[model samples]
Each structure stands twice: as C-alpha cells, then as structure tokens.
Target: MNNLTPERRKGRKYDQVLEGARQAFLQDGFDGAGVDDIARNAGVSKATLYSYFPDKRLLFIEIARLECKRQGDEAKSIMPQNLPVRDMLSFIATRMVSFFNSSLSLSIFRLCVAEAERFPDLAQEFYRNGPLMAQTKLGAYLREATERGELNVEHPEFAANQFAELCKAGIFARLAFGVDKRISPQESSFVAAEAVEMFLARYGVTQD
Candidate 1:
C-alpha cells in the first residue's frame, strides 16, 4: 500500500500520465491540447490529474523540466575533458544556442517567461536545471585548470558562469525575443575562439 498523500499519489500517477502527455505535447503544441485529452491519453482519471496539478501550467512546466534535463545531457556532450577547454566551451556555446530553438525548448522558454509574474519558481527552476547545470560542469574544468595553474580562477563556478554567459549571448538573447537562427559551423569556430580569448583574459595564468 502506498502511504503518499492525495497530491503525492497524483504526482505518481502523473509519472505514467506524463509519458503520454509528453508524446501528445510534442506532437501537439501547448495551446492545442486539452486537460481531458491528456488525462485520457494517460489512462488516468480527471480527478487524479487535477489532484496533482490544479491547472495545465504546473504539469506543462514539469514536462518542460524533463525536457530540459534531456537538453542538459546534450549540452554535457559538448564538454569532453579530452579536448581543450576553449574548444569545448565554444562548441558548447554554439550547441546551447542551437538547442534553445529546439521545438520543445523554445516553447518551454516562452511558457516560463510568459508566466514569470505568476510563477517565479518555474523561471528559477528552469535556470537551475538548465544553464546552471551546464555551468557546474564547465566549472569542474575550470577547477582543474586552476590546479594546473593554467587559469588562476578564484572561483571555478563563477568562472564557469562568466564563460557560459559570454558564449550564450548570441543564442540566449534571441530566445528572449522570439527569434530563431541555427548556428553554423563556421560561426561556432569564430565564437569559440572569441570565448576562449575572453576566458583567458579573465582567468589566464598571466595576463599580458
């Protein structure tokens, strides 16, 4: 027997329901779906669905989180330690820009920003789960560089943030204004060089 609260039980039920809802949401945009349709598609009761989430907003955001986690993993693929940090970060920045425009990602960004006033937590959660996660990974590399005395980073995490922010300026800014552009390979190389230059300037072993 499960001892979870009604809300929690609904949350669990959503685990199953969400798999279906995710398929539906991806196949159909957010505005095109219905609560009953999602519940029906999930093989759950309307009451059960409502018990966990009073509205579609909460449920959609959770789905967005799941989607963001997938994006985080993809971003991680760009940060292989076998490669140079500048090469890796430049690859990461371009990938980040490209990913923000992914159908689900762009939608999630819009949803979170649109509801920022009503739900600040969602915005924070998106950041923590997405870019913040990327920064932590990047910070690990910076920490390694610091130990080697290649980059004199006082705070690896902060260094990671600065690096990521500088690199993402192109793609992230576009997401904010409903613009869509795919980054090219040539562009990635250019941005990667500049980002590497910037990171070196901020925390190089010795500034020239």
Candidate 2:
C-alpha cells in the first residue's frame, strides 16, 4: 500500500502517473513492478506513461528528485535566522530527522539499497538528490554561521555531513529496516537536541 491516502490518489495527469509509479515501485519494488500496472493504476495507457517517463528508471529518478525538493523546501521554510546557534541547529536537525522517519523517505532509501546494484545510475540519482543536496545546503549554512561567530567550523562540508549523521543516529537505520515505522515526536526532539549539543561541543567558540 505504501500508505498513500485516497486524497493523494487523485491528481492531474502527470501527478497521477508519478503517484502511481511511486506506489507501484514501493509496493512491488523496482524490478517487480510492471509498467502496465503503473499505467492502469494511474488511469493512463502504457503509451501515455511512456510519453511522460520514457522509462521506469527515469520515473523513479523523477520521483526521488521531487521528494528531495519537497523535503529541502520544507526544511528551508522552517529555518530560523538570528536565533541562538543551538536553536537554529535544533530546528534544522528536527526537520531533517522528521523527514527521515517518514514512510516515503524510508521507501526511497529501501529502493536505493535494493536496486542500486542493478541500477547504479538510479542509486546515484537518489544520492545526489537527497543526501548530497542536503549536505550542500547545510554546508552553506554552516559557513554563514561561522562568519557570525556562532561556531568555528573550518570545513563546512564535513561538518554538515557530521551533523546530518549525528541526527540520524539510532533512528534512520531502524526506520529503514521496518524495525520502527513511526518515531514519536519526543524521540525526534531528543535526537535533534543531542545532535545540536554534539555539534556545538565541537564547534562552539567557547568550547574547551
């Protein structure tokens, strides 16, 4: 089912096809999901689906890219400026962990793991759209924060990756494997706080 609601089930033709493809891929996996099933579910013919996507791999990449953009926009929208360093970091980390805990995100992670060997380009696309893009934005933020004397990060890229990793610790792996489908807000907050604390410990100007 992939947990897509009926409300999300209806949309414009292009979105309908993308949503159907997402459901098909998640439910049946990349290799197992048939284009016929995807087209039928989308209320489009195979020809229409092909016209839009050309190939299943391209469809999957588009889905991944769209999701990544959505996540990035969400996190960016909530980002606070002129706040305390810890507060800003906490806000960012919480949003990130929340997205990582989502079913759609987990499904994408699973797809990359399951199909990467057979479809290396697909995996690379996901990586670039998801984690690599996030790291780039986070690194830019870190650089700006450093200039304001909120921290002392010499390597913003490395620090961004470290912060993201710390926020995902103890949660992302478990969620991806189905050990936990939903993480409580309390737990997410705790992890976000810990990530901020550790990051500040390493980079704060006052830290010994």
Candidate 3:
C-alpha cells in the first residue's frame, strides 16, 4: 500500500533514488545491495544518489524509517478517541498485529536483528521510528483512558509497552525465525482478543 502522498514525496529524481534503494534492499538484502547498483537501477547519476543519501547504510536506514512511520501513521489514523477502553485496545492491537505480520515488516525486522550488533545506531533508528513511537503514542492514549476513569494505569508508558508485547505474544518469534510467518484473520483476531483481555485485566477499572 502506497501510504505516502505523491505531493509530499515530490521530486522525481529523489523519489527514484528511494524507490531504487527500497527494491535493492528488499531484493538483495543490506549486505548485498550496492550503491552502484542502486544508481543504475534508479536511472540516476551516482552524484545524484549521493546527494540524497551520503552512504548506503543511511539510505537503508531512511527506508526502514519511512516504512515504519507509514505503518504507524496508518494505525494512528484509526485509533478512536471515543471508544471504550477494551474496544480501543483491541483496535490498536489488531492493527499492530497486521502491520507486524506483513512480509515487508518481517524482512526489515530480520535485517535489523541480523545487523544490530554491527550497526547498533541503525537498529536504534529503526526502533525509534517504529516500536518506540508506537509505544509513546499508545501511552498517550492509555493516559487519556486513565483520565476518563476507564483504566487504572499508574504507568501509561509501561502499560503501553506491555500491551504491544501481549499482542506479539506467540507470533513474533515465529516470524523472526521464518516459521509460520503468515497470520490468518482468525489468528490475528485471537491474538488481539487475548491481548486486550490481558491488558484490561491488568489496568481496567470495574464498577462495583
């Protein structure tokens, strides 16, 4: 899904470089993707490519950041401010699970895991733009829910992180290892339901 608007992603040559880099990284993996190949595929001069991204790692990191931000934006757009706590949590969890289960997301995650030790900064950049941003946004939502007396969360940040983890529960490891990466709607529903239940059990307030 092309989440980026053409107007916002203007500049024909700039877009070409990013598109070329994305294809190269996805097809060849980080280690195998070359700047020269990216330039050739992009149909841009080496100078043009370098003008946008100083190094290959920077290019790859930017791509990862863009994709992660896109996913987050999509998820955020659907987060309802008026929904009940359980319903909102369920919605967020389901959206996150869908994003995480995608082939593109899985590929980027695998690359981050494999290269994190050598390129810690790149991994940090990925985390900041992806999971960390999600957690922060979710924390704000949880805080709002608490203010509305829907939940008993004392630490919204911690609760947010835990909810996201609960959503990933039995699926992330399988995805990382390339085992049963595909998730059916039924499976996603099950995970989202369980995650919401567990999260509400911990933080939801009940009227006696």
Each candidate's root-mean-square deviation in Å?
5.7, 7.2, 6.6
Instruction: List TM-score per model, in order.
Output: 0.61, 0.70, 0.71
Ranking by TM-score: 3, 2, 1
Best by TM-score: 3
User: What tens digits encode model 3's per-residue C-alpha lDDT throughout 52-80?
Assistant: 77777667766886776676677567566
Q: Between candidates 1 and 3, name the one with more favorable lDDT.
A: 3
lDDT (0 to 1) per candidate: 0.68, 0.78, 0.78
**Backbone clashes, each candidate:** 0, 0, 0
The deviation in Å at residue 79 for candidate 2 is 4.1
Show the lowest summed lDDT stretch of 10 residues, model 2.
1-10
Clashing pairs in 1: none
Q: Stretches of candidate 1 above 4 Å error?
A: 1-59, 71-79, 181-193, 205-208
Which residue pairs show backbone clashes in model 2? none
- Of 1 and 3, the candidate ahead on TM-score is 3
